[model samples]
Target chain A: MSNIALEVRDLVKSFSLDGATINAVDQVSFQVRSGEFVALVGPSGSGKTTMLSILAALLTPTSGQVLIDGQDLARMNEKQRVKLRREKIGFTFQSNNLIPFLSARENVEFMLRLNGRLDHASRIRSDELLARLGLSDRLHNLPAQMSGGQQQRVAIARALIHNPAVVLADEPTASLDTERANQVVETFANLIHENGRAGIIVTHDLRMCQYVDRVLQMQDGKLVRTYENKKEIRELARGSIH
Target chain B: MKNFFLASYLAIKEVIRNRGRFLLVALVIALITLLVLFIAALGEGLANGNRQYVANLDAQLIVFLEKSDFSISSSRLETNTVKSVRRVDGVADAGAIYTSSTEIVSLPEPLKVSMLGAEPGRPGMPPVIAGREFRGGEAREAVMDRNVALRTDIEIGDVIQIRSTQGTEDEFFDLEVVGLVEGQSYFFQPTIFVPPATWEIIRPQSQSELTSDTPYPNIIAVKLADPLQTETMSARLVDEISNIEVANIETTINNIPGYSAQQGTVQTQGFFTLLIGILVIGGFFQIQILQKVPQIGVLKAIGSSNGVVGLSAVIQIIVVTMIGVGIGGGLTYLFSLGFPPTIPLVFNGSRSLIAVILLLVIGPLGGMVSIIYAVRIEPLKALRLG
Candidate 1:
């Protein structure tokens, strides 16, 4: 029922490596209404990932205000921020990033356990999420036992299992083959359309841009353009957008 | 919290993935702990045996007779005072002995000895290895330690000259070897025994006139029907035994100059060695925690809290250290068995237990420091690196 799941204004982040200051993200501002699926498209090293990190509450912008459902993240303390993050944000990395020692089910259930909320519903949800992701047959399989695509699905299941309001994914299909990438993109689209979650997918592959409802293109630490439709993005691919 | 548990599970997985490093650290910590413990345990076990051996000889208590606050010159108790102490209430048999240092010459070289003079009815020293026993009133007879007696001419009726100093011509005497004793000296030098009457002739009198006290002998050996009455007997000696000192053997030998003080020094050194062990563990784990920064970044980026990621490393460190130190300490105890009692190595349980606990704490405390640094590793930066 919230107006926006995530809102950022005048975000600026720079890093001083050795003695020179390099601006990684500069004055980037955006908002995601509930159930919005946004794709961040940028050239390599164009600060797309930095913008996504700031949105996920993982990175503190050197100067800016990030608000989730009207709560300002810049003002929240560490415990409050962690609580907000755990309850609100989900992340899917490009690398299948599954815990190598844990079984697929355990990886899903671990989020519930980490919350220290052991309920029948959480357990049921973990099982249901794995099955929903077509991983019911590979429930007990570790990351090594599963293929890259299977691992990516498990990672998605982990992200959504906690039922967070916002899901921030960084190149969720980078390690997958073409088919797996499409499947993962479809899942992200479903997460917004079917589950009413705000999802941000940062990717270089324009193929995934079709799954997102909106697309933002970046160039040199700035959002140079935005597109209101993913189908438009897929149909019009001349490396220029407005 | 869910994020925390998930991250923790993941960290442990990552930690174990680098088994070669973790195992090596664990093994080194355990082995070092074991080695120190082995030395310590052996020392303590042997010391316990020595203490027990000394206790069984029936020394009720001990007393110190100082030549001065600064010096430990020899002093004698008047013979008449011995007769008076014999008359005290619960009065039992009491005799005199002289303790001294002298030298013994065998095949390889001349060895220094801590000597004790025996009188009648005073329980003769126990034999563990054995040469022979001292007989009464023998003028020219002495006893050597049994351990080395077989290899030398320290046999019965063999003459061995005992000198008070390396170059001193003033104090020397030849005596027929009478007996040998076993398990006598681990902390002490190899022992030689002579008769109390012979000691009366051979003991060095102080040049200071104040020390020329009337006495039976300086050291009195007592046998009581009731050991519980030591306090009463001690009091009686103060008042009743005129011009004679009746003190126990326990306090006298142990209270010798630099004796008790040296024990404190050894214990302190042992304590710091344990601290060094702890620091080594802490240092190794600190470096390990630093190396896992990227993993922590991944967890944090996934919405894991600092508490979960930091404490996971701590728990991991504690588990590894306890396993390592436990095995090390156990092996140390086992290794101690081969050490002889005369090795001057003592394994003190209280000291070692203190060391083990101290060593154990280093892991977690060091983990805490490392965790603080680990938490500072930006999750965003970590993600970028990944």
Candidate 2:
């Protein structure tokens, strides 16, 4: 099998607004291998959200090929796409939408429950993952009872518990303070790398780029630069390369 | 099967987590159910009060005068008509029945009572429970219904005074109660049965007809040899006997004055109650779904299919409705135990069962629009990412 867990080739998504067609995602292409964490960073309206949505299989591109674990999304029907999304993809939104009624552990195990794999071992794994994220004491706490940072960490645990081929985080730390943001991102990175999952984090905060293995920057719906060197990525994380 | 379990888990957990809000809505539903069930029971009770005597008649056919439109008050049959009806091929026996209304003055309060006169050992006479049946030729003996015994101190062997208006003056005749029979209520009043000769002497009369003694009965109760062949026997009796119309027991009961109108009014009230139930339930769930659009979107994004979401909502509605109906049923039973028999509230088992089934079905039906709305919510739009 190839090392690439997610591959996107020339993806384009266009929307018709009051009769005129505009391209939200214009001919974007990238590939992330297993165990690699990539950061997609750009200004607002630079097609970062559109790119993430297309990668999440939530929005169909006008024309493109998105293959996760060697299965092409464009060739699958709606039912098949939903099944694929459940089995091969995991995403957390900007709000960290943990179901307010469920406790921290139940929120994490919901992913496995959706996939019909919530057994005793998966339950134990859910507890262990939360414990690794430093939420062992807050396992039975509801989202309303926990802090914003604690809720975001629970969201991250939920994303990784299902062991999907691709893990996507869209502004997972947007609701936290700077210190809490750095802690959440570092833990998220460690869990992704330890599980050998291809992880993608979409953020406009340049400091969050420090935890990622590579940084892909976009401008005017195009890839403007690629930062791959460890020193260069470190400099970008310090906000010196903007 | 796995999907069902998952859906149930989510639905039940949410209901438990937010029990206060759900329980309030369920209580509203329970109140609605109680209203509907009470209306149904009232309808049954009123109809039963009107037709109990006619409904309990042991005969299969009631022969009324032709052109009387099956009305007991308007129909008149001569005493010889009973013999002609008994001579018919399919009729086993026939008896003359005379009906009138009078007031019983023996009690502290004047109680209105239905007076029916029939011969002893006849099909029209109800079975005795307390005392022996009155002899056929007795002029002053009577048998009272159990409802009369319930209302006052009158019982078997008691001499009750019957007050009737005759020639612009109220005359009272004394009669001894010889027997007590159960549940012979008619025209919403307790009944007293007497021999035909005594009925002729004491029945109410208008001042204009103080001297005329018409020896005619209101109708003839005919016992059929083959009760299952009522249709054929009715046709044969109409053909054999002139100036007479033959109706089965059900048709006779339905034709009682105000019976159909009472039933229709009560049924219409029940129907409107169910309509209000639908609106209340529908409105509550619609608001609930609107408030949780974001949560639903997040669920959709996390690989929860529309099937799971829709199924979960349905399960929630059914669970809530079951709780409401269960409480309503229990409350209805407990409340029914406290009512006096004069209030006319009775719950029939099969009718109550039908009402319960209707109550259960309306829950899912009322939540259908909300279910469709939940299923159509796009994950991208719900999260406000698009």
Give TM per candidate: 0.72, 0.95
lDDT digits (tens) for residues B14-109 of candidate 2 = 899899989987888788888888888888788778998888888999999998889998998877889999899988888888999999998899
For model 1, the stretches where C-alpha displacement exceeds 4 angstroms are A1-3, A9-29, A62-64, A144-148, A220-222, A236-242, B1-21, B42-97, B100-276, B338-348, B365-368
Could you tell me how far off, in angstroms, the CA of residue B2 lies in candidate 2 after the best superposition?
A: 1.0
Q: What local lDDT score does residue B209 receive in model 2, on the 0 to 100 scale?
A: 62
Clashes of 1: 24
10 residues in a row with least lDDT, candidate 2 chain B: B206-215
Per the 3 Å backbone cut-off, how many clashing residue pairs does candidate 2 have?
Answer: 0
- In terms of lDDT, the poorest run of 10 residues in model 1 chain B is B63-72
Candidate 1 DockQ, CA atoms = 0.29
| Residue lDDT tens for model 1, B194-244 | 777666555444554224333235445566668888777776666665444
Model 1 per-residue lDDT tens digits across residues A1-242: 53688888988889898999877888888888888888898888899888877777776788988888788989988777778777788777876366565789887776666566658988887888788778899998888899988888888888887777888888888888888889978976885667778888998988778777788888888888888865578764444543
Question: Against the true two-chain complex, what DockQ does each candidate achieve?
Answer: 0.29, 0.67
